[model samples]
Target: MTPAARLSAAIDLIDIIDAQRIPAAKALKEWGTAHRYAGSGDRAAISGLIWDVLRRQSSAAWLMEDDSARARLLGMLRLERDMDVATIAALCDGGRFAPDTLTDGERAALTSRTLDAAPAHVAGDYPEWLDPYLAKAFGDDRAAEATAMASRAPLDLRVNTLKGKREKILPRLSHLGAVETPWSPLGLRIALGADARNPGVHSEEDFIKGAIEVQDEGSQLAALFSAAKPGEQVIDLCAGAGGKTLALAAMMGGKGRLIATDHDKRQLAPIHERLSRAGVHNCEVRTPRGEADALSDIKASADLVLIDAPCTGTGTWRRNPDAKWRMRPGALEVRLKDQAEVLDRAAPLVKPGGRIAYITCSVLPDENGDQVRAFVARHPEFSVQPPEQTASVLWDKAEDFAKAALQSDEGWLMTPRRTGTDGFFVSVLRKL
Candidate 1:
């Protein structure tokens, strides 16, 4: 399909998403199913257009002086794709299957509009209600930070040391232009363009042979800071689909007894296959049944309890832009309660001198530092680990890592603007 036709499809999909209050992924999939004749490339291109519009929805609307779906597509082309007014006008030249030709008002708006006077929320492309929270987290640079997250994310993959070393497996993925990630020694990153299709890495030999697993560099670092060692008992309190559990298993070198469990059994379903694929043997999956305690047998015995706590995924906006617009204030309140409960759940599981690694893919203070403080207050036995000591695992790059991340007495915050990673907050607290 021509680029112009793709734009038309994207605008239609955006309308469906706004009207039904459904996720862009769902809308895109339904549109694909209904339009079977659209080839894979066409679908991919259309999907990219829709996602770009969502990512820049607020800023684009402000630029075009209109909030309509068509205006979003036009403005997004200018802001995200960097298309000039004349180029965009040609695409919308009233051609068959293309969007209508731009009116004089649109042409003038696109040519003259600038975001200099736009509000922070609009410039950042985040929900207006989240301005205070973002401001608290990033201060005056909140708009810059949010704008970084509004861009495309690179595909980050962690080498499964359980199968092979990163150095050995690095060559295997080089065909996909994979490069070592800045912060994670075990991670390889593949840069993704704003509208490019993800390479078929899942079909690659390394991925199939369990040598690689797709994980954000921030997430890999979050697991790294946990500092799980071999022969040490670790409990992944909220393993979910076991992304971090797999990373911890590799860190443990398969020597420790790793217990993975979640509150929802359904969320644990994919973990077994993933664990098997990664060739992990020391890990065990425990599913909750009724009122029975899944970790009843290991209370007060764990050396490390990692809680990849549930929270607003503000940090992941680059990858899931549609979610930010759909997110509501009440959702943050719900996440705060869930995070508190999960932190409490991890408290008893850690033995003296053992640590609880609190992690969230969120930049919100209410979920990160604030939660850590609240947890420490409730559990006087635990002491917060300095960000320096926790990040010392980076060795030679430790100081550089510190410079890249927002460090505090509570924890480290990694953002795209600072660390070229999705927003992640990790704090390790020790039982004294």
Candidate 2:
């Protein structure tokens, strides 16, 4: 596709996203289906451009002094893509399937003004409502963190211990030019290249046979906090597709039962197939017949209960930039309330001496550290476990940031900017 055509596609996708209130990915997929003439490369390029624009849409619009999708697309080209005014105008000049010709003002803004003077919110491309939260999360480094998150993220994979060890799989994956993730022993971070479009790694014999699973390094670290032991019963209270449940099962050496449950049947339903594909046998799926059936017979029965609670997903803005645009303060409040309810309901499932690992892929303190603090206050019987003790129990497998952050009684906050992985917060509390 021509550069102009790609810009046109991005404008169309963004409009659909803004007008229909649909997700960017879904909108892109639907657009692709309707435009079957677009080849694989065309789809990839268009998707990349769309995501890039979304990541910095607020700032891009501010620079262009227009908020429409086309304006944003042109702004992205001017600011991010670094295209000159003459080049953009030439591309749009009477070309078939090209974007409509730019107005004089639009062309002038693209060629003349400096964007360095824009406000922090516009330059950072984050919502104004999130300023306080981002400040709290990053302290003095919020701008740097936000900038890092605006860039594309690398692909990460976790070596599944159930089928093979990292040592054995490392040799096989060497052909893919994967490097050991600096912080995660079980994670392999692959370098982006021209052939990055190939999904061969996930479909390879090793992945198909459960030697590895595509998971973020931060997620792998969060799963490690479970500290599953042989013959110990574990419950993934909010297991969505059993990513960490399978990790816990591997930690248990497949010796104990791992029951994975979730309120969303559609999400949990795929776990059975994934578990089979990963060669995970000890894990079982349970769908609550109703609200009453969820807590019955399981109160204080699990040696370990993992609450990978739902949240605003502020930490994953890099990968899902559209989420930042769609999120509202009201919706975030509702999610926080839902998270608290889930924590309260799942707390009782941990045995008296057992531990509960509360986790969320959120950067906000209210959804992470603050939530755990509140949970601890409500349940006097539960005490925050020291990071050293938890680390020792989990085979001493912790990154430097994990050791430092988890050293506190509250737990650890893993950020993508700091840790080069997804943002995750994990707190382990033991019942007295």
Candidate 3:
């Protein structure tokens, strides 16, 4: 497909997304089905355009003085991708399946003046409602932090020790130019290529045979925070499909009791299949009979209880850019309430002197550092565990262990900007 046709497809998908309030992935899938003539490359290019536009939508809108899909794409081309105005104009000219010619105002906005200064709100790519929260979380570097999140992320995978070590899988993935992540011994960072979603290495026999799992380096780091030992009982509360559960299983050498439970049965249903695929035994899946009845017998029984709680997913905007735009201020309140409830319910499952790890893939303080602080305050028996001690138990890499141990008044915040991984916040707490 011509560049022009790709632009047209992006416009169509964006329009559908705006009108139907559907996810960008759903909109793109529907658009692709309707345009079956487009090949794989065409779909990839169009999807890239849509995602890039969404990631920098605030800045793109500010640059173009319009928020239309075409305007956003044009702005992204000129500013983000560094496409010259002449090139964009040439593409917009009456070409086959191109977007309609650029409007007079859009052309003027593109060429007339320098967009040297964007307001903090636009540059941050965050909604106005989130400014206070972001400021509190990031302090002085909020813009830089948010800009980093707005940028594209690398493909990271964790080696499944249950099947093989990183050394074993590295040779198999060499064709894709996989490199060991500098900080994470268990992580491999793949060089970005044209096919971002292909999961090329994951489709290989090694991956299918439980040699590796597609997990973000940051998420792998969070799973390591648990430090589950062999023959110890652990509970992955709110374990959605058990990504961390698999990591924990490998950590435990597939021994001991590892119960993966979630309130939603539909989400837990796939864990059985994944467990089979990964050759994971000694893991059990539990669906809540009712919130009250589920795990009633297990209170204060677990050596480790990990609450991978649900949040706004603000930290993962690099991978799922559309979620930021879909998130509303009102919805965040609902999420905070749910998180508190989950924390309250899961806290009792940890044995005295055992640790409970509170985790979220959110950058917002309300869901992360602040949440941990509130939990400690409400439950006097629990106190924040020293991250250094937790890190020592979790990581083999000396540098990662040192970095992860930094003390915070409440807990640690791992930003993509600082950690070169997805944004995550983990707080380890112990019952006195």
Candidate 4:
């Protein structure tokens, strides 16, 4: 399809998302099913346009001086894609299968507008209600931080040391332009273009042979912060789908006992296969039954209890822009309650001198530093470990890692702007 047609499709999908209140993925899939004539490239281009508009939603609306789908696309083309007015007009020309000709108002607005006078939230492309929370986390640089998160994210992969090393796998996947990640020794990053379809890594022989796993660099780093060692016992308290559990397994080097369990059994389903594929053998999977304690046999015996805690997922906005717009105040409140419950539940599982690594893929202080502070308050036996102290496992890189991340009172915060990873807050707390 022509680029103009792809733009029209994006506008149509945006309207459906706004009216039906459906997820962008669902709408895009339905559109694809109905329009089978649209090839893969067409679908990819359309999806890219849709996501670009969503990422810059507030800023686009502010610049165009209109909140309509077309206006947003017009503003996004100018500000995000760096398309000049003439290029945008040619695409929106009243031709067959193309969007209508740009209105005089749209053209003038696009040509003259600037974000200099817009509110922080508008300029940052995030909800206005979240300003205070962002402020608390990032101080005067909240807008700049949020804007960095609003950009597209690259696909990251972690080499499974249980099966292979980075040097061995790098040459195997060289065609994909995978490069070593900045901070993670085990991570490889594949940069993505605006309309690029996600590469089928699962189909690669290396992945089939259990040498690589698609994990965010930030998540890999968060799991590393736990400092799980060989022969130590670790409990992955919220091992949803076992992403970090696999990382923990690699860190343990097959000498430790790792118990992976989640309160929600549905999230545990895919983990069994993933664990097998990653060639992990020292880990046991625990599924909760009605009114039963899954960890009864292991209470207060674990050297490390890792809680990849449930959160608002604000830090993942680079990948899931729709969720940011759909999130509500009530949802955040519910997440806060969940975090407290998980923290309390994890408190009993850590042995004396053992640590609980509290992690969240959220930039909000309420889910991160604030939650850690409150947890330590309620559980007086536990104290927050300095991020630098916990990250000592990184050896010579520890000081550099500490400098790259934002150190709050409770832990280290990694953001897209700071560490070029998804937003994550990691704090290791030791039981006295």
TM-score of each: 0.98, 0.89, 0.93, 0.98
Worst 10 residues of 4 by lDDT: 386-395
- Who wins the lDDT comparison? 1
lDDT of 3 by residue, 140-253 (tens): 778778877887788888888888889988988988778897666688888564335555775788777877888888788788877888999999998888899898898899
Q: Which residue pairs clash in candidate 1?
A: none
In the range 55-136, model 1's lDDT, one tens digit per residue, is 9989999999999999998999999999999999999989999999999999999999999999999999999999999999
- Identify the superior model by TM-score, candidate 2 or candidate 3: 3
lDDT of 3 at 366: 90
Model 3, which residues run further than 4 Å from truth?
100-108, 111-116, 193-197, 393-407
- Local distance difference test, candidate 2: 0.80
Global lDDT of each candidate: 0.93, 0.80, 0.81, 0.92
lDDT of 4 by residue, 253-321 (tens): 999799999999999999999999999999999999998999988778889999999999999999999
Q: Is candidate 2 or candidate 3 better by lDDT?
A: 3
Task: Give the candidates in order of lDDT, highest first.
Answer: 1, 4, 3, 2
Rank the candidate models, highest TM-score first: 1, 4, 3, 2
Candidate 2 structure quality by residue, lDDT tens digits, 77-195: 77666789988887776578888888899887887776577766677788888988888877667766776677667788988888888887888888888889877778888766321
| Residue pairs with backbone atoms closer than 3 Å in model 4 (clashes) | none
Number of clashes recorded per candidate: 0, 0, 0, 0
Question: Where does model 2 exceed 4 Å of error?
Answer: 78-94, 99-115, 193-198, 388-399, 402-409
- lDDT at 354, model 3: 86
